[model samples]
Each structure stands twice: as C-alpha cells, then as structure tokens.
Target: MISILFLIAVAASIITAIMGLSFLISCIWEKETRAALYAGLQFLLMLGLVFLLFYLEATAFFETATGRAGLILGLVLTGGTFALLTLRIGSNPQALQGTRGLMVGNVKRYDERDIVFARNRTLSPGLEQYQAYYELHPEHEQYDAARRKRGGPLGKPGSIDKPQDRPNVAATLASLSIPLHLSTPEKFNPSQHPEFSQQRVELSPASASARIKGYTLSIGAKLVGITEINPLWIYANRGEIFNENWDDWGREIELTHKYAVVFATEMGFELVGTAPHSSTTIASMANYASGAFIATQLAAFIANLGYSATANHLRHYDAALVPLAVDAGLGETGRLGYLMTKDFGPRVRLGAVTTDLALIPDNPVDIGVEDFCKICKKCAHCCPSNSIPLDDQEAVNGTRRWKLNAETCFDYWGKVGTDCNICMRVCPWSHANTSPHKLIRTLITRNRYSRYLFNSMDDIFYGRKPKPKPAPEWARFDE
Candidate 1:
C-alpha cells in the first residue's frame, strides 16, 4: 500500500511539473519574460513541496496511522494548490457575460467631417473648415495654431527621417479605381431592378441565426456577436446626409434590422508597435480593407438568404460603432474609450452587418474592467497629445462615461498623417495574453485586492509609459 501510494504521489508531481514547464515555454514563445519567470517559479515550488513530502516519509514522520493521515492531508493540500493554479490560468471573467449596449443621450451629433475639419484647422494657415470651427469654439484657436506648425506623419520632417509620403499610392489608387459607389445599394438604385419590388426575404429563426453567425464568423473574423437594435448607437445625422434634408439625418436613426452582428479583425501588434510611421498607416489601411471585405461578403450572404442586410465598413458610416460593439458582446469600453475586447484589447478593427434575422442577445459582461480603467490611467498618462481623460467617468450629455477630446485627438492624427495609436500601444490590457497575465486578469475580476496588485505590477513589467518600437520590416516600403 505504501509503495503504491508513493508511486501515485510521484506520478502526480511529475505531471504537474511538466504542465508548469510547458506553460513556461509557451510564455517564452509569446515573448513574455515575466510570464515565463512566474511559470518557472510555480514549477520549482511544486517540486520542492513534493521532495519535502518524500523526505518526511523517509524520516518516519508518517510511520503510524496518524502520520499516514497527515500524509493524506498534505497530498490533498498539494492537489488543491494545483487546482487553484489551473483555475487562475483557464478562467477569463471578461469572457463570461457576453455583450452590452451603452445608451448615450444628450450628446450632440458630430459631423462626419468633424475629425477631418478638426485636423485641417490645426494645421498652419488653416482652411475654411478651421475658421468655421473656431467661430463655434473660439477658445481652441491658440492650441490649434501651435499644433498646426508640426509637420504631419507623411509631411516633410515628419516621424520618418527620410520623409517619404505616398507609399504604394499607385497600388492604393488602383485598388480604389474600381467604382466604390456601385457597392452601395442606395447608390445603385435598387428601384431600378424589376425583381426588387416583387421579391421579399425572410429572416431565419433565432437559433438558426446563431448557427449562421457562428459558422460565418468561423470563416475568418476573430470575434462575433448579435445584439438588439439600440437607438443611441445610431447617429443623429451630419454632413451630406444632414445637409440633404434627409429625414433620417440628425434624428435617432435606428434601423428596422432586429439583429446586429459585430466582429473584429486583429490588428497586427508587431506592426502597431511602430506608431506615427508609414508602416502603421499601411497596417491600418490593410485592416480596413480586410474588415470591408468581411462585412461585404457577410452582407451579400445574408441578402442571398432572402433577408435585407447592410454592411457598415471603414470610411463610410451612419452609426456609432463602439456602443454597438459592446451591445453585441464584443467588449467593454476602456480608458482610451475604445472597445477593449476579451482577446485583443484595442488591437482590432471593427465591422458590422445589420439584418432582420433572429438571434440571441448577449448579456452584458462585467469583468471589473470599468473599475480597472478607473484606477489605471496609463493610457492618459502616456497620450502624447493629452487627449485622453485622467479623471473619473462623468456624465456627458446624460450617460456617464469618459468622453475623449475629439478635436485634440483628431488634430494629432491629422498632423501625423496616421491615426496616432500611442494610447493603444501603451495600454496595459494590450499586453500579450500569457499565463501570468491570464492569472492577473482572473484575480482582478474576482477580488478588488488583485486589481491594486495588477495595476502596479503592470507598470513595473512594462513601463508606465512605453516608447514606440521600430516599424516591422514587412510593413516598411522605404527600407
């Protein structure tokens, strides 16, 4: 009996050690030095405990029934330790409750051209849009004037030392050469088609819709969810849509589509590490293209199934995306006010397809992210333009949340010629998912105590404000 028990104990210890070692190796593969160290320490600790048990046995500490009972107690405790560690590694609370919607009110309808207008205004000797904008917000003129003098990302004396603009512009132009207007149903004039008035499409049942979404998302998209229509997610119209006196413009523009599908394409992290560079621009445009393709294809597929659907992609949009994404169970909004999904943080580009199809609505997930972001202002601290807010989430219009300075943020992007993702690059949530990070995410979700620990540790491991890395070779055209 003693021999058999000893053999079992040894086997269990060996298996535990192997798992720990495997996790350590996996961490190294992800370039996570801290995770590897943590994993190695866990393995060593287990080994020491097992060896100590063996020493006690040999020294006659468990020769009697009482000693044997004590031996059993130690083994059970050791097994519990392993279970606890396993739980920490496997459970991600953020993934638990699915999607949620943010019902924002009182916010003014920002023009689609607002960002472009803001950027242009910040440039030296600004354009007509700049003067018009300043007439509304006169206090911003001084700051705008100062920022405009800095050369843009693609401008002369920009971030790139050589200052080369229009990388593969020929290729980009060729791609855009294909008539994009024809892609829009409204532009194509659906009324012109004889069958358009005669044919009607039916929505699939909720169960079938779920299956379809699951199957289609598995095709390539990173994450997918279905959400009910929310009025706040739509924009009160602006720009040409507003100027044309369209009834839907500048109103709560909720669609008849009962189901909204939100999915994300992973941003190549290695490429994003090189912010304010040509490579970063390339990656951003590439993701936009990829998202557009995915959304277009999905919309077409839904239409073929006899249901009306529309794909909202890059460049053109009629509704707000982040709230829709959150409602669809994608992720919660983080400190940077970007949708921070469970798997990718802000390292994703989003696309959506709305349809009349029936589907299950995901529950709102609370992984303590709001609380964490409240305390962790790493992004705000590192923001070069100081556009991100450092204070608590406040009521903007009516809904309570952090409202980013759109003008300042857009101004920075315009000057850089690239969407400055300095905040995304430095976000603690953007860290590569490794065992230690997984453990920390789990603990923080469960106990407030762990939140404090992780907030500090994250800064120590990766600096409170990390510097941007060099652009990747594959993305660099002017090497």
Candidate 2:
C-alpha cells in the first residue's frame, strides 16, 4: 500500500512536469516570453515535487502510518481538484442556456442604414442622403460629426498616424480591386431573375450540404456552415456604400433566398499579432479577399447548378455576418461582438452566399463562448478605445448580448490609421492552434469550471495586457 502511494505520487508529479514542459516549449516557440517564464517555473516546481516525494518515500517517513495517510490524503485532494478542472465530471457544455444561463428575447432584423459603417459613409454634407438621415436621427449627428473630425475618416492620409499610409493603402487596394478584376462575364440581375438562376436543379439537402461544404473548403474557406435563412440575420436595406445596385441609398433589400452558406477565411497568426498596425490591416484584407473569392465562387457554382445565389462579401453585404455565422453553427457571438468559432475563434473574416439551393442546415452551436467570455474579459482589458464592455452582457437589439461602442472603435481606427485588432489579438482563444493551446480550448469548451480554470491560466501565462509582436518582414515598409 505504501509503495502504491509512492508510485502514484511520483507518476502524478511526472505527468504534471511533462505538461508544464510542453507548455514552456509552446510559449517559447510562439514568442511569448512571459508565458514561457511562467511555464518554466511551473515545470521546475513539479520536478522538485517529484524529487521530494521520492526522497520521502525512501526515508523513515514512509514507515509511519500517519505520514503515509497524510500524503495519500494530500494527493487525493490535489488530484481531485485538478480532475474537476480538467474533466467534465457531470457537465454538458452544449447544454448551454446562452446568456447568464437564463437567455431571453427574440433578435429583430437590423437595418443596414443604422450601422456605424453606413452612418460614416452618409456623413458628407453634399450627399442628400446624409441630410435626410441626420434629420431623422438628430441625436446621432453630433457624435457622428465629431467622429469624422477627430479621427479624420478611419485610416491612412486623414488619420493622426501617417507613416505607414502608403503600405496600408497598398494593402487595402489589393483587396478592394478583387471584385473589379476577378469576376466572370455572368452576373445576377436582381430586377430580372429574382429567384432560381435559370432552371431549378433538384438535389437532396444532405448530399448538397456535403458537396457544398467540401467545395467551400477546397476553395480556401477555413470554416463553412449552412443555415436556413433567418429573417433577423438579413439586412433591412442597402446601406453599405454608395453604389448603383439600388435606385438610391437605403432602398429596401429584398433577398428571397431560403438558405445561406456562411464561410470564414483565417487571418495569418503572425500578421494579426501586430495589432493596431499596418500588418494587421494587411492580414485583415488578405482574408477578406480570400473570403470574397470563396463566396463569389460558391455563388457561381450554385448558380451554374440552376439555383439563385447572391454572394455577400465586404464590398456587397446585405446581412449581419456574425448572426448568420452563428445560425450556421460556425460559432457563437462573443462579448467583443465577433463570432467566436470553435477552431479559429474570432481570428477570421466572414463571407456568405444566400441561395435557393436545397441543403442541410447546421443547428446553432454552443461552444461555451458566452460562458467563457463571462470570465475572460481580456479583450475588454486590452482594447485601446475601451470599446468592448467589461460588464455582463445586456439587452441589445432585443437580445441579451454585449454591444461594442462602434463610434469610439471606428474613431480609434481613424486615429491609428488601422482597424485596431487588439481585442482579437489578446483573446485567449486567439492563441495559435498548436497542441497545448488546442488542448486548452477543448478543456475550456467542455465545462464552466474548466473555462474558469483555463481563463486564469491564460492571464497568468500571457499577462492581462499581452504585448504585441512586430510585423513579419514582407509586411514591413520601413525596412
């Protein structure tokens, strides 16, 4: 019995030491010096514990029943505590009651005209739409005008920061030009064929779903999901930018699609690491471009199959991407107002293709995003503009959720000459998908206690305000 307890103690210490060592190595490879230092100390402590246990077992202490009993009790207590943190025990993470566990209210369909991006575009005094909109929403006129004056219209030449303006403009134009240069001769005419592309192509929902998902991945989409179109996810009007699509701005957007194929493309980890910098903008645009390609190609493919499909990308959006992503089972909405995907978190750009094609729809997923975000407010702490809310989610748009201060966030973007991704960069879920971090994600996704455990671990290893890394060589213009 004494030998058995000694073996257990030594084995547990060894296992812990191995885990610590793995984390230490992972942090070092990821260039997280603070995390690596913490991991190294943990490894040494476990190693010391192993040696102490072995020494005690070999000494006169093992001969005493009281000493043996005390050691056994300590091991049991410690092991049990860790087990609770690491294992589900009796918890079901998917049985999530999404908001503080008592979820409430139906989300109403949002008006595209009301979004900050639309408001910013309409702020020009020369635009007739600007005068008409401000007349109705006079309360927002002061702040919106201030945002334009203070921040100077979000990025590059107009902002307070200007050194990287050339590189930022270069990166942005590369993405903006995709739609103009990368299209086929064929196009959708909303006034003409509003439903089926030409003729209906009958296909079973399951097989169509499988084929579509496979093709989306093949076309560079990192994540793809299908959901029956939810009216609430669709926009009420055309308000993204001044374009010829509508007779005038804010025209009612009438999308008659029954299903939406939502997809996301991953942003480069190293590039995103340089948040609030030109590099992150480069990363953001790169993925947005990729998403545009994926969405357009999927739309074309479906159209070829004799189904009506309208691609929604950054340049031509007609819906709320995050909610559509959520309904598609891709992820849940986090407090930072981004879709928290299971594998990639919010470190992705979204695109969608709404169509009349029959496909199996994915049920919404609950990967403990709400539960975890409740504990890990790292994004809120790291946000330069204080845009993300640190408190519990409140009712917004008729649903209980966190609403980011769009005005302040966009204004900060103009100040920095980039859309600051400090929130996404510092999130624990934003860690590289390496073995140790993957394991951590799985553990947290399993239960609430595990979420709390990993959340603290993230803060301890990676500090509350994690430092940003420098951009990759290719993205650096100064050099």
Candidate 3:
C-alpha cells in the first residue's frame, strides 16, 4: 500500500510536469515574454519539488508517520485545487438564461448620429446635416470641437510620434476607399440593387437557415447565428452616412424584417497584439472589410433565394451589431462594450443581415460573461483613455450594461493615430486560443471560482497593465 501511494505521487508529478512544460511552450509561441519567463521558472520549481520528493523517498523518509501524513495532505490539497479550477460545481450567480435578462425595461431605439464616429467624421462643419444635428443638440458641440482639433485617427502629425510609414498609409486608404468613402448603401446591399430586385428560388425555413449558416461559415465567418429581429435593437435613424449625399441620410430606418442572421469574424490574434499602433488599425480595417464582403455576398445569395434581405456591414448598419449578435446567440456583451464569444472572446468583428425570410432563430446563450465581467475588471483597468466603467452595471437603454465613454475613447484614438484597443488587448477572455487558454476559458464560463482564480493569474502572468507588442514585421514602426 505504501509503494502504491508512492507510485501515485510519481504519476501525478509527471502529469503536472507535462502540463507545465506545455504551457511554457505555448506562452513562448504566444509572444508573451513575461508569461514565458514565469512558465519557465514555474516548470523548474516543479521539477525541483518532484526531485525533492524522490530524494526523500530514497532516504526512507516515508517510513516516519509524520512524513506519510504530510505527503497525503499535500496530494489531497493539490488534487482539490486542480478540481476546483477544472470542474463545474455550482450554478452561476447572475448569468442570464435564454436572453431572459437581456432587457430589464423598455429598450429605447438608439440614434446612430449619436455614435462618436458620426458626430466627428460624417457630421463635419459646413455640412447641412452637421448644422442640423448641432442645432438640435448643442451639448455635443464642445466635445466635437475638441475631437476635431485632434484630427483623424490616422493623422500624420497625430499623437503617436512614430512615423506612419508607406504600408500603413496604403492600408488606411484601402480601408477608407473600400468601405467608408467609396461605397454607398445601395452598392453594399443586393436587395437595394435594381437588377436583383426580385427573388428567383424558394426553400423551407429549416433548409434556408441551415444553408445560410453553412455558407456564412464557408465565406470566412467564424461564427454565425439567427434570431428574430428585435425592433429595439434597430437604430431610430441614420447619422454617420448622412453627408455621403444619399437621400436616406438621417431618414427613419424602419426595417420590418422578422429575422436577423449575424456573423462574427475572428481578428488575427497577433495583429491585435499590437494595440494602439497603426497595425492595430490595419487589423480592424481588414476584419471590417472581410465582414462587409461576406455580408454583401450573403445578401445577394438570399435575394436569389426569393427572400428580401438587407446586409448590415460596418459601412451600412441600420442596427446595433453587438445586440443583434447577442440576440442571434453568437455571444454576450462584456463590460468593455464588445461581444464576448465563447471561442474567440472579444476579439471578433460582427456583421448581420436582416431579412423577412422565414427561418428558425437560435436562442441566446448564457456563457457567464455577465458574472465573469463582474469580477474581472481588467478591461476597465487597462483602457488607455479610461473610457470603460469600473463601477457596477446600471440600467442603460433599458438594459443592464457597462456604458463606455465613446467621446473620450474616440478622442484617445485621434491622439494615438489609431483605435486604442488596450481594452481588447488586456482582456483575459481575449487571450490567445492555445490549449491552456481554452481550458481556462471553459472554466471561466462554468464555475464562478475559476473566474476569480484566473483573474488573479492573468494579472500575475501578463501584468495588470500589460504592454503592447511590437507590430508584425511588415507594418513595424520604430518606438
């Protein structure tokens, strides 16, 4: 029996050593230098401990009652700790079920004009739309004026002192010309195109849903979901695209669609590592463009299917993509005001298509994002502009959510010459999708204790305010 107990200890030590070594390798691959160092030191310490255990056995220390009892206690405690981290032992404290707690009151329709981008970019002074918007809401004038002086995010003489290099400029121009400055809504949506005004084929709701979801995945969408359209999620009117000289600018957007299919595309983990840099903006643009292309193609496919569908991309949104994504069962909103996906965390770009086609809708999921965010305020702590809220969630727009200060956040963008994505970069959920991280992510959405455990570990492994990584070689800039 004593020999058997010794053998068990040996096997347990081997398993733990493998885990430690694998994590050390994964951290190196993830470019987490600090974490890699930590992993390395931890692996060595475990190796030393294992050796010490064997040395004691060699010295016949286990013959003593005190040594045997100590070994047993150590094994028991170690087993309990691992089980606590890995097992699902209890119910969530407050995770909503099937979207039941999505809304606590009347969800008010949001005005797209109030979005920071619209207030600063599209509603430029000297435009009629700009004058009308300011006249209606004089309160925004002071904030808008401050942002205007700072110039655009890619301003050559902007806050980031580093040179904006040629490749960076080209990428920014491509993003603007392709999505924002060049294409209009009519060009983006197939249903709006005169040639595809009519549907050609028809299929049952069940078949249509499956086909659409499959196609979405095939065409670069990492995640896809379907849900009944919630009118409250739709914007009350257009604002951002008003001055692009379309008649529908600022017009009431009444999308009477019964269903909405949402798509989420994963942003490159390495690319996002270089947050607050021009490379980060490049990542954002690339994903947004990919989402636009995928959504547009899908709308055309639906038009061919004899259904009325309207694509909602970054450049042509009639509704809030995050809310639509949540309703579509893709993920839940986090405190940082981004979708926290089960697989990709907050590192995803969302696109949607609202349609009148009869399709089965997916139920909203509870991934413990609400409960996890409550304890893990990493995003709030790391936001460069202090835009994210550190306090508890409050009722906003008829729901409980952490509201980000968009104006200050965008202002920091102008100062940095890029979208300061420190929040996304520092979020523990946004960690690289390695095996160890996957294990942690599973526990995060399961037991609440895992949230607290991993939260502290994240801070220790990656620092409370982690530094941004250098950009990809091609887009690299001198510090």
Candidate 4:
C-alpha cells in the first residue's frame, strides 16, 4: 500500500509537469517567452522535489521514527498547498448594476470634431467650417497649413505620394476603400416584403436570448450580449459617411429596432503586439471579418425565422458599437476609452446587430474595473500620442468616463501608417487568461485590497511600460 501511494504521487507529478510544459509552449507561441521559461523552470524545480521524495521513501533515510513523522508532515503540508493553488481556477467576473441614475446635467456636449483633430487645410481651403475652425484655433494655423500644402496623410507630398512608395500606397488604399454595402431602411420597406413574424417562436425572452448568444458564440464571437436601444448610443448622423455638414441633434436618428445584440471577436495577442505594422492591420481586419461573419449570419438566421435584423459590420455602422457593447454587458469601458471584455480586455473588435425581436436585456456590469482603472494607467503611460487620459474620470456626453483625444490618436496612426496599439499591449488586464491570472482577476473584482496588489504586481511582472516586441518571423516575411 505504501509503495502504491508513492507510485501514485510520482505519476501525478509527471502528469503535472507534462501539463505545465504544454502551457509553457502556448505562452511562448504567444511571444510571452519569458513567462514560458518561468513555467518550465518551475516545473523542473517541482520535478527535483519529486525525486527527493522518492529517494527519502526508498532509501529508508526518512523511515526512522523521527524521519518518518517529519516526512509525513511535509507531505501533508505540500498536498495542502497544492490543493489551495489548484482551487484558484475558473473565476467569473461579477455582474453588478452600472451607473443607474439620469445622466449628469453638467456634462459638456462635445462636437464630433473635438474627438478628431484634422488639419483644417486638408479640407477645401475655402470651406466655411475649415476656415472658421482654423481662425478659432490660431495656434494650429502654421502646422495645419504645412500639412495641407503637403496634402493630408493620404494626399500628395505624403510618404505614399513619393514615387517609390506609390505601389504600397495604392495597394493599401485599395484595401481601405473597399466598399461596405449598406442599405438604408428606406431601401427596404417591410410592407413591400412578405409578412414576417411579429413574434419569436421561443416561449420566453430569456430562452431566445440564450439561444441567440450561444449560436453567435459558436459561429465566432468571443462575447455576446443584448441590450435595449438607448438613444444616447446612436449618433445623430454617421460621422464618417457624412463628414461635411453633419446634422447634429437636428435630424431624428431613431431605430426601428428595439434591441441590439452586441458581440466581440478577439484579436489574438501575438498579432496585436506588432502594432503600427501590417501584421497589426491584418489582426484588426481579421477580427472585423470574424465579427462581420457572425453578425451577418446571425442576422440572416433571424430574418429566415421571420424577424427583421440588420448586422452592423465594419464601416457600415448605423449605431456606435463600443457604447452599445458596454451597455449590453459585453464589457466595461477602459482607460483607453474602449470596451474591455473580461476575457480579451481591449484586445478585441466589436460588432452589433439590432432588431425588433423581443430578447432578454443584459444589465451593464460594474465589475470594479472602473476602480481598477483609477490606479492602473499603464495604457496612458504607453500611449504614443498621449491620447489616453491619466486623470480621473470626468463627465462627458452625460456619462462619467475617460475620453481619449481622437485627433491625436488618429494622427499618430497616420504617422505610423498603422493604428498604434501600445495602449492595448501594455494594459495589465490584457494578460494571458491562465489559472493564476483568473484567480487574481476574481479577487481584484470582488475586493478593493486585491486590486492594489494586482496593479503593483502586474507592473513588476510585466514592466510599467513594456517594450514593443518584434513581429513574428511569419509576419516579417512576405510569402
């Protein structure tokens, strides 16, 4: 029986080492090579301890009365410690009611232009809005004129305009300008089509929502939720589509849809670490493609079942996705001013499909992430353009949240020829979803004390501002 017990312990230890080796490989593949090395070292250390155990049991070195008792006690203590650590797995972020009262009255209404700073000269030199903004903000006059004369980021005198760079610019422009086919509501009147079901076949709203979320996730979504249509989330008019003469609050932007199904598709970490490069853009487009696939498929499924649904994908957005995602319980807004889902943090792209279907509504979750963001400004510190806020949350658009300077952010992206994602790369919440990290996340979400420890530990484990790693071999070479 004693020999059998020893054999069992040896078997278990070997199994653990194997598991650790597999996890280490995954970490290395993710470019977390240091973490992988640490895991491997820990496994070797544990294996050495296991060898010591076998020598003690076999050689009778620990079989004397005192030695045997000491051996038994040590074994018990080790088992208890292992059990404690093992128990710290599979944590779920708590679901709490988010800010509920009416939006603050003192909040300032920001012009859509404030979110983005553009060289006024890039606009038609004599355009009324361009002339007025330049006159108002005179300090930008020289810089704006310089950039305008050079022709905006995409125009002549830019890097892309250089003769040798033409081929690259043309290729990129072709990809970026690919048309997203979007149909206006007026284009498809419901009365003209065959009668669609006014009600769902599912008996309960909860059941229908669960089925929809499951189906969406299985298709490609990393996270999914449904929320009631909030007027605040809908822009008065689509900004990119109607840049000039944007009608703000004058035109009614009502949706025939009553509910929105918000979902996110994760952009793998290794791909995002190479931001401001083609690899990063590929990762971004991959997420967008995945999101579009799932959203459109789900919408088609709903339509086939007789309910009217429309997929909001990529540049064809009718309503803002991030705010809708936050309100839908898919995630909380992070310091970078993007929705950070529990699993993927800010390292994912979002899509939404709004419909009139009677689906269960998800409450916006307040998982202490706001409090966590207060102490953790890793993203702010790493932001290339200093666009992310380092200060406390302030009232913006009637809601209390951190608002990033979009103009500076976009300008940085244009300069790099890629969307710089240093903020997402350095975020403490963007760590790999391992058992140890999940336990820390659970404690931090529930107790305020753990949040401080985690913030400090994260900065220590993964430097305060980690360096941008080189892209993978696969990314560097054009096949």
Ten contiguous residues with the weakest lDDT in model 1:
239-248
- Each prediction's whole-model lDDT (CA): 0.64, 0.78, 0.81, 0.65
Which segments of candidate 4 are over 4 A away from where they belong? Answer: 1-19, 56-95, 99-114, 117-179, 183-204, 242-252, 289-311, 316-318, 366-368, 371-376, 395-398, 431-463, 472-474, 477-479
lDDT of 1 by residue, 378-466 (tens): 98998878899999977765556787886777767766666678888777766556665565566665555566667886776556776
- TM-score per prediction, in order, is 0.73, 0.89, 0.93, 0.73
The true-versus-predicted C-alpha distance at residue 467 of model 4, in Å, is: 3.4
Q: Taking the tens digit of each residue's C-alpha lDDT, what string does model 2 give over 1-479?
A: 77787788888889989988998888888888889899999999999999988787778587798877878898899888787877654343442432223246766677888888778764576677788788988998888887766654335455333565576658766886775443322432121244553665667898889999999999999899888887777888767663433344778878899999999988777878888776788788778778778888888788777777888887677788887887788888898999998787889899998988888988777678888998888999889889999999898866778989987888888777787888989988988887888888887877678898789988888888988887767776454
Clashing pairs in 3: none
State which candidate, 2 or 4, has the greater TM-score: 2
Candidate 3's residue-wise lDDT over 25-127, tens digit each? Answer: 9999999999999989888887877898899899988879987997888889888888887677555433444344656888779998888887876877787
Scored against the true structure, residue 89 in model 2 reaches a CA lDDT of: 42
| TM-score head-to-head 1 vs 3, winner | 3
Residue 450, model 4: Cα distance from true site in angstroms = 6.8
lDDT of 4 by residue, 167-252 (tens): 44454454444323222332121221235445444436777798889999899888898999776666553333322333421234
Query: Which 10 consecutive residues of model 2 have the lowest summed lDDT?
Result: 183-192
Q: Which stretches in model 1 have alpha-carbon errors above 4 Å? A: 1-23, 32-157, 160-198, 215-219, 240-258, 357-359, 414-417, 433-450, 467-471, 476-479
Candidate 2: which pairs clash?
Answer: none
Using lDDT, give the best candidate's number.
3
